[model samples]
Target: MALMITDECINCDVCEPECPNDAISMGAEIYVIDPGKCTECVGHFDEPQCIQVCPVECIPKNPEHLESPEQLMQKYHALVTAKNDA
Candidate 1:
């Protein structure tokens, strides 16, 4: 599943740089995760780097954007290919 940042995010700015997919960005209030670009770091890391560095522990699975591990891997591959093409 893709991850989301809750309102509890302190805006510490740590999570943004940690996201390899560039999914995390500053929203109107807090950091927001773009589900389209989020693959839970499956292609880059063993775990989600944003969640690892978030001090408030506010990042959680996005229920509305749930995907299986295999699906996530597919998304990861697509992202990589798109990035390479650019």
Candidate 2:
């Protein structure tokens, strides 16, 4: 499943760099996760890298964009392929 940054985010700027998928970006108020690019670090790490570095624990699963592990792996492969092609 993709993860989201809640309103509780302190704008700490830590999670943005930790996201292996480059899904996290500075929003109007806080860091936001792009569900289309988020794979919960399935292709890179065992755990969500953003959650691991977020001090306030604001990152949580995105209910609206839920996907199974197999789906996540597919997405991860797509992302890698897209990057390689560029």
Writing each residue's lDDT as its tens digit, candidate 2 over 1-86 gives: 88999999999888888888899999999889999999999989999988888888888899999899999999999999999999
lDDT of 1 by residue, 14-65 (tens): 9999899999999999999999999999989999999899889999999999
Candidate 2, which segments miss by more than 4 Å at Cα? none
TM-score of 2: 0.98
| Per-prediction TM-score to the true structure, in the order listed | 0.98, 0.98
Pairs that collide, model 1: none
What TM-score would you give candidate 1 relative to the actual structure?
A: 0.98
